[model samples]
Target: MLLAQRLPQAGTRPSWPRRLRAWLPAVPALLFLVVFFVVPVVEILQGGLYNADGVLSTAQFARMTHTPVYAKVMLTTFWIAFLTAALSVVLGYPIAYLLARLTARARERWLLWIMLPFWTSYLVKTYAWMLLLSKTGVLTTIASHLGLIADTSTLAPSMMGVLIGMVHAMLPLAVMTMLPIMQGINTQLVQAAETLGADRATGFFTIFLPLSEPGAAAAGLLVFITSLGFFIVPALLGSPKESMIAQLVISSVLELFDLRFAGALSTVLLLCSILVFYVYDRVVGLSSLSGDAPRPKGGQGGRALPVLLAIGRAAGKLHFHRAGRVPGNRGLKLYTWAAVLLLVLPIAFVVPLAFTRSPFVAFPPDLFSLKWFGAFLSSAVWQAALWRSLAVGFSTAVLALALGFGATLALSRMSGRYSKPLFAMFIAPLIVPRIVIAVGLLYLFARLGLTGSDAGLVIGHTVLAIPYVVVTLSASFKRFDWRLDDAAKMLGASGFTRVRTVLLPLLASSLGAAFLFAFIVSFDDLTIAIFVSGGLNTTLPKQMWDDIQLAVTPTLAAVATSLVFLVAFVVWLSSYFKRHSY
Candidate 1:
């Protein structure tokens, strides 16, 4: 009778209480996201769909459609974003390929250069570009000296300048995304093709290129989605005609005081972003972004093989052939060096300008001085902003790590049916535009009296930071040997003891990496600070924005240089932990 009772449940599911208990570890993170991210975003979308009297209406959306200026801005935003993604992918592919071919140690050395701009503050990079692209700036002066253009010609305040800055900002991200996929490609496939009488160019084009398409496509999608919400680069580097939808949304709120209209604009952007994300998820799977090899559907590559082979034949025909000869490696190395130079040139210029004696931010200083650094050190406002950023960044790192660790652990134990959806939910913050999150939180925080408070800043930054934490931790957890926990348990260790001794020690490197990423995300944030800080309590990035808008001086350069050093120190510390963690 007891056997019958146990066997009789063949068609039945687990009890509701049992299922609920299974998800208990994830409850805290789920609740946090629901309260801070989902609820606020829904409220913002609702605001756009209703009038002041709370009656249902679409007047705001109607206004958006009917206004020619708004229409132009939407078109411009998409166009620029599309171009940025396309160019970033194209330009980053060679670098990713080169890095993929290098030895691990050599690749790491090169990656430091690639990631330098990524670690530097976006505001700092933008300002450096400003100095470089200005009429009398370094690039223009150099070009004029070489007779590349008239002495008065400049790059800034134009679409060309906007593209240059945007592509520069996104190139590192594209390379990082593609490099993993490229590295995973089997070199044997190309060697086999060459052994079968195919030339090197033919083998690379027919086999390697097709294999790397997924990575390139993934990189393009990510860059495009990220570029859609960019306001800082466009606002600073381009003219009014180049205004993006994000800029418009900011204007509607701060300048026009039209919350309803701003909500509508954000809604349009949110929907577009969601649509793109949906398409990417269906085609490549969102898991690709987190380092999973996306499964290509059956017959997908078969359909493209013929076209690729044809292209390969054409490429082979164009290759210059000589007896016992192959192309030189020096061209690839030169291209890589040039790309690295472009990435570091702006920061290199800004550092020197920071130490210049001139009050003006000139590239070649007449004399060296430390007055700008002194100014930054002595200013009460700068000190407060720096401290505020550090505090919020640390708090955000702790909170995000706690939530992400629990959620990731819970997900590891859950079934795929339950876990995949939850994983998607966790990473959704990354897909949604920062401006949308910022605008939604601004409304939610205002009603809760949390604006201008440090707690509010921490919460906002934590929401953004959690995705990074989850991604970093998930990669480590995927490869972790869970049997260690079982071994500890078998030795009569309790849950807490097993976690403290077995899990923590094993995962220290990943934990440190996750913590550093979360901290950097919060530290470099400007969108959330602009909305949640309310100008009264500013973070470092927000303060920099205010200062830059008010006046451009050597002081800004000094601040940028300081930030570069801080990031360098943080990176060095992370490396130290990694080296010693074992």
Candidate 2:
């Protein structure tokens, strides 16, 4: 009894041994991030502050702060980001609203429509736009005939074209982000407002709008951040005079060979991104981005809520549509369907162009043939790039799945205090602009003699792919029952044996999904690969980027078509495996 009294109390001090055991799984992932992610970022920062001779200096920042050209480019980038975010919200809001209000079956169908373009390659989508807006392209020729413009030359490489392409690429992301929050909103509350006295428009403006602020904020943040790092669309669609910040960063490194200048540009861009993220976090909380934020408590709206409800009720007597069969407002359907069409129009335009034999990117070709498809498959250059992409994608998926699985497992066992910060660290790469990450990695890899090598591309792609793996696996892990493993342990099973017998079998489907997601992410990546990959290791997107600059070719159209089929098949396979997992 005296010895027991002298010992520490059971809850007073945590056991170090238990804590260390829980943290052990996360060590490998944390170390991987330290070497590949954090160290490179630090190197970029140091490069911005130091000279080539290894002495501390700031002369390299001359272009960013002192040059008028850099300032103009930065402004243009911000302008585009702002406009893109605003436009996405405008185009996406109605569809998201419709999605939230529709029946389950309708919602699934419309959601599939929105997600189809999202699954396709970004470069391919941009190429589609290039074809549509080109001199002899379908839309351009029709517009010319209709007196909309003199020719396609007026629109092909303009700022308007860039904005259109960017919005098309980003609208799905905005809609997806906002849809969850809108769906989570208690429809009953809106109905209660209607039953009391409110109309649809008034209810939407006063009640729904205010509550959806968090989702709106998140959507805007995601769109703007992605816009800031856009390279392929702007480079392909916009004129030289209208280059964005990312274009300048690329030029600084690839054209000028000015590593220090490129580092400075990246640091500035990174700082801007961090500042925006921090402010948004403080106001709305990062949980909004994941669509899991807690609902606000009731009775806090005061007199304003009831007053708005009264106005809505007074307006409720006036019916807007007499032919309505859908459950929600009919007026919204017009805008929502138009937005959906806008989203799919480029896809509709590009798929048929693959078989055309007009010798140019003309729609409704004079003749149809399989010539381009054969050319893409047979050409040594195209074949080499395609093989490289497949190899890198496979390696990236394996590495990311391994690391992300370890991190997710560790988090599943971790307490709140340790898990949240670690989770943020894991996702930081996603939030940081890709251009900044690419430039930083380029500097670090060049210094370590890893540039132009398969190992380097794999490492870079893994860093990009890991976040998706973590997100997918974490959700799956949370849904899983760990008690099965405990029961196995109770039966005298070893740790590895429990994992192999219980966890792995149960999680096999999720593992496959995560692997495919990583593969697609690595395969679609162009921003990072453009900066990191070289002549020998050129990936498909980089090859296409080069080809586009030289001339628009039918082979590109064929390749884009093939990528679509590939992505769709993978998605279908993933779904089939998941359904059969039981």
Per-residue lDDT of 202 in model 1: 84
RMSD of 2: 4.6
- Cα error, candidate 1, residue 115 (Å): 1.5
Q: Which candidate has the top score in TM-score?
A: 1
Residue range 1-582, candidate 2, lDDT tens digits: 433334324446678866787787778888988898988888889989988899998886775778888888888999999999999987788788888888876876676667667777888889988888767666778888999987535566888889988999999999988887888788777678657765555566567866777787788998998899887888888887669888888898889988788888888888888899998876666666656554444636433566756655554445521332222566678777888888877876676778987787765655578999999999999999999999999999999999998888888888878887888788778888898888888878888898888888899988888888887787678778776776676677976797789988899999998999899988888877887888665999889888878987777888988987887688776665556563
Query: How does residue 231 of candidate 2 score in lDDT?
Result: 79
Candidate 2 residue pairs that clash? 197-313, 198-312, 198-313, 199-312
- Best candidate, lDDT: 1
Candidate 1 C-alpha lDDT tens digits along 193-227: 88998888788778888888778888988899889
